[model samples]
Target: MALDRLPAYVRKLRNAAGEPVYYWELPAWARPVKDEKTGAMVPAMRNGKPMLLASEKLGSDLAEVHRKAQLLNAALTDWRKGAEGASMVPGSVEWLFQWYRKQARFTSKKAKTRADYGKLMDMLAARETKKGAPPFGKRRAADVDAAAADRLYEMLRADTGPRQASYAMQVCRLVWSWATRHYKVTGVKENPFMGMGLTSTAAKGNRATSRAEYTAYRAKAVEMGFQSMATAAALCFEGCQRVSDAFGYVDPDAPDRAAIVWEGYQPGVEITLVQSKTGNPVTLPLFEEVPGEGGGVERVPLYPELEEELARSREATRSATGPIVVEERSGNRYVERRMSNVHRRICDAAGLPKDMTFTGFRHGGITEIGDAGEDDVRPVSGHKTLAVTRIYNKANAEKARRIAGARRRHIAAIGALDEARTK
Candidate 1:
């Protein structure tokens, strides 16, 4: 390939190992020199080394190599400008983002959360002020008021979907909140993304598994020889727990024993653990009438059907410990995605709606308890707040009417008893 035809400053060099490598060479002024205080060489007099572009070592195709080269060149250009003290303005959105990434608020996020936030940041970085204006990242942070934020949110929702737009707004709100408390950035008295009423266009996930639907799905699972999946479904509904927690059991010998454990079964058996997502401690009873407060018997019954399925799973696995749900072929614990596939297959076989999900079992169980006038279903559902518990309850007008009719019947029974006593 001709060097002249390639982007400027992006040249191929032969490494000491006699392999071709592409590198983006810095200008003389931008090149590293020894720091007087540290007595160490740094790239662009910064803490990093010179940029290495695509190479045969990367094993990327030609197009990907070229794309990476372009990105590296853009980053080098920014570095060179920074070296000349002519980089992004101090109070610009780009500068704020750079600072935000270094803060505890951003760094402390989980790996998955950070990755999602990174995608949102990339989307913001690619956005323009207007159709052909400068990149949104380079715009002044102070210029983003509530109205401007709303307009940007509307545009993003239209361009992307509601979920992505809502997430982006959340990221923006976090950055702005941190800036308001820490940095004295101008025109940021309050977070612009706050109280925006940005709603998700996606449908609400309020579907609950009906008893018939669950029974059909379980029958299909058994017929397909996926007894483990049937066991998982039974646990989710009877235990009133998420599928992840129901199937996340690990053996004592496993490396992640500290994170997940399979507590052995006994009468009034319960698995006491902290939820992975919410960190809420929950005690899931495997049988009815577990010991309750003040020596009163609280009914947390394990249905006969669920009990039978669990026994079948135990007999099939032939193990007293380890994950309750395992692939018959591999005899290994099911990952989250595999468990999801099991649910999807069962749903398909049962002729259930596509939107019917494994989580709906928990929702259905919670709603059933709620309909029975159980004031507290949080112990079974492990919801952190009553509000969250209520969200899972899918009771509608029909359920309300049934409860009203039951109340009237009870009142008539009381009247009959009183008239008989008077006579």
Candidate 2:
């Protein structure tokens, strides 16, 4: 919490409990004064003297402090310039985007997500049409129809690709919906970007990795002295965790980094996790058993590879204090990009496909569950709906085999009945 890095006109003070709190204050010149006759707060002056304004209390959370401070700064600028300081022409797409950025929905998104959306917005504002008359951002929101949105999508699809174009349209659709519902954006009734039947190509390169490929990748990683990477991949494949969640990164704001701790894990028993992306509580079992026909239970290790890898990692870092997946060279958690690079190296050494990414392992794990004839994958996959979980069920070989066997039995029964009737 550096004082110089904080926004202008913000003060940091300690509360009674010794916790820091933030507050925003406006300059006397820009502050609105209360009128004696109208009993209303308005910008005015009496005897050429400026009135004092109370400081606004921003929460102690640093992120919240920054968001509130930004909005207040915008207000201060508008007040200082009166009617002349509007950032953009009202009711324009550019204006809408700028406004939307100030809202909580945009500010509260993950940093990576916000940055991606920012790039798309900037591209939209700078893109030129064949006529070269004006950029799309300058167009009035009121004038934009479904046809105009379609043209914009087509232009983006041609310039970039279908994946990028679909994402851009999705973002615009959300912005339009938010503006329409929250603010009375003039002449903007229907959302033009809605229901465009967008088909995304985001999943084109990320095909599910096979179990054999995963095993080879892990073996290669371990041979290359990337023991942490090996365990991280296992977490993605066996635990069905995202890369970010599995190999936690250093958070500058927090005292401790987010990762799997030794306390949550009980080898050959169970492990608990609260997924960062969806905030869903996931408890994964390391061992399972089912009833056998002979009145005995057949034991199944839920994630035997992961369990063994984690055990080895614990033994190596027995004296060190931190996450389970610490770099052997450095006793720190593997950053997401570093992990991905190591995974690529392992894939090349293992003679696997170049497109086989660490993310695909998670998909592979879910698909394996589906292939095993699991009725519900939402619990382990942390998906809110069966629909979302079904997307990862790529290998339908077992399902097809079951249907084929049923059809064969039906044909055989039909032939027998027909022969009996003839006799």
Candidate 3:
């Protein structure tokens, strides 16, 4: 296209290398403005560098050039219009969100966490009073009472389902709490979301993987050449660890190698590491030997099944160090989601219930130990409290039945003794 045919402020210039470059120059009347998406000053002209026109690279694509020019013009116009719009009203939900974003509670979160929360905030911002009314975010914060909070939660639940509704409610509760404590806005007494009853409809019960399920899943994984999945299952089951901690890795050469590495094959030895989620230090015994009833010999605690899986993984990676669970094809370390997908696939092949997840291995192992009346599993599970461990104990019903049977037998024995003494 000819230079005269291009829009105003669209000019071609020569670089230091004498190559042609095209960029848009903001009008002299327009001042530097902040771009909300990037938090950067726009109309960037430093070092003779500004927003490059895609059309310049497209060559003879006149249609693409026109589209790019239109988009750039529209963006500039929108920025100018937004700058002239009304400012956020104090005590409004929008104002509170802006203030909350600056607080340590929100700012201290990880980038991914903040991004996830931002999606929920966007959802809340789009929610209208009814169907075509103003957005809920524009409503005054003080106008939200307990009933209003409940209604909003109900709406969110109906729209997005319980998990997202619960999560959104949690974010709102945090902001409302911060506002109640910090913001001195009048008519704002207590946080309406504080005591709002928002329960998750997500399944409360996690199906524990049975011994049969574990065996079947492992066999299927090995048959499919997914040794990493088998290794992950063993790690969670034997170590009583969460999937994240089970698959966690650090540089093999790092000083923290001891925390993740399993040393030599000593029978009574244990592997020590800190739990990734709870940060609680845990020592998992490598073996468990129990004395036979006949007192023949002491059993060795060597976990041959787990050892085999670990050895298989090590052979696959050809490394003495690094993450045990990895992609079979690329030998890349597995992220949590990727590992979960592998687990799901394995479960499908094993014909296991849909509710059985990778996490169930940890819960099942812990529950099995609990069923055996062994409190030592707590050290391996790395639960902060016995209560937390009990929560994972799905063998409570069986334990209760066993206890009841034992009580009945003891009562009968006492009655027999009393009758014998009377005779």
Which clashing pairs does model 2 show? Answer: none
Q: Which digits, one per residue and each the tens of the lDDT, describe model 3 over residues 1-423? A: 553477655666767888655566666646455544323344433322232212223233444444455445543443344322254466777667656766789878865466567567645744654753556766888888888888889888888888889999898888788788875753466888887766684657777886567778889999988988887787777666786666663222232422344442333455455475666555444543457788866544434567778778778778665555666765555544456677788778878888888889888777666654565454556666423354444353233334323333443565687899999
> What is candidate 3's TM-score against the reference?
0.58
**Residue pairs of candidate 3 with colliding backbone atoms:** 287-301, 288-301
| TM-score comparison, 1 vs 3, better candidate | 3
Model 1 segments more than 4 A misplaced: 1-95, 108-115, 128-135, 138-140, 143-148, 184-191, 199-205, 219-229, 249-262, 266-302, 315-318, 325-351, 370-423
Ranking by TM-score: 3, 2, 1
- Ten contiguous residues with the weakest lDDT in model 2: 44-53
Give all TM-scores, in the order shown.
0.54, 0.54, 0.58
* Every model: Cα RMSD to truth: 14.0, 18.0, 14.2
User: lDDT per prediction?
Assistant: 0.63, 0.68, 0.62
- The superposed Cα distance between candidate 1 and the true structure at residue 56, in angstroms, equals 22
Give me the candidate number with maximum TM-score: 3
As a whole number from 0 to 100, the lDDT of residue 105 in candidate 2 is 93
Write down the lDDT that model 3 would get. 0.62
Please estimate how well model 1 matches the true structure, expressed as its whole-model Cα lDDT: 0.63
lDDT of 1 by residue, 1-423 (tens): 432455655566676887766655555666656544323343343322232212223222444455555554555565445422355667777677767777788878864466567557656754654753566767788678898788888888888878888889989998888888865643456688889987774567858987667888888998999998887787677557776677763322233632223454543454554455576545544444447887978864345566678778778878777666677766766645456677788788789989888889888766666655655555555666323354433232223234323333443565687899999
